[model samples]
Target: MSLQQQFEQAVTDSKALPERPDNMTLLKIYALYKQGASGDVTGERPGMMDFVARAKFDAWAELKGTAQETAMQSYIDLINSLKG
Candidate 1:
């Protein structure tokens, strides 16, 4: 399957989880997955977890004030666009 197909599958699968993920976690996971899938290894950057990644996750969580389905959908849309 194409990357776009994979992303679409991921989006559908993620949404089917019994417990929805926090929006920020979903966003960060989306970012990491995109970077990894593209061979950027940005997700593997040294200190990414301690510095930027964690911060972004925290910020998203705070900004949403709760898990936001829209944020997850946005992440899915981003991946779809990237794959296009």
Candidate 2:
């Protein structure tokens, strides 16, 4: 399957894992998915007062300059690990 398709499928499968993921794992999934789909962060960072938004933005920002294919592969690998 195409990498993007595989990424999408991994996202779906991740939600079906036997055990729930911790908050950090969820955040990593969110960040990697965003990076893989959109490539790097965009717009302004969320204000520090907005913890959730700030966290998401920060997580995505950390992946700045990462290649889309790399992000997708990383996301897929993480999902597979979580599944097992």
Candidate 1 per-residue lDDT over residues 1-84, each given as its tens digit = 654555567666655655555665556765544443342222333355476666654444343322234444455665444443
The true-versus-predicted C-alpha distance at residue 76 of model 1, in Å, is 1.6
What lDDT would candidate 2 get against the real structure? 0.92
1-84 in candidate 2: lDDT tens per residue? 999899999989987998989888888998999999999899998887999999899889988999989999999999999988
Candidate RMSDs in order: 12.3, 1.0
The global C-alpha lDDT for each of the candidates, from Candidate 1 onward, is 0.50, 0.92
- The TM-score of candidate 2 is 0.92
Error of 1 at 9 (Å): 1.8
lDDT of 1 at 54: 68
Give the poorly placed runs of model 1, Cα more than 4 Å off: 1-8, 11-49
Clashes of 1: 0
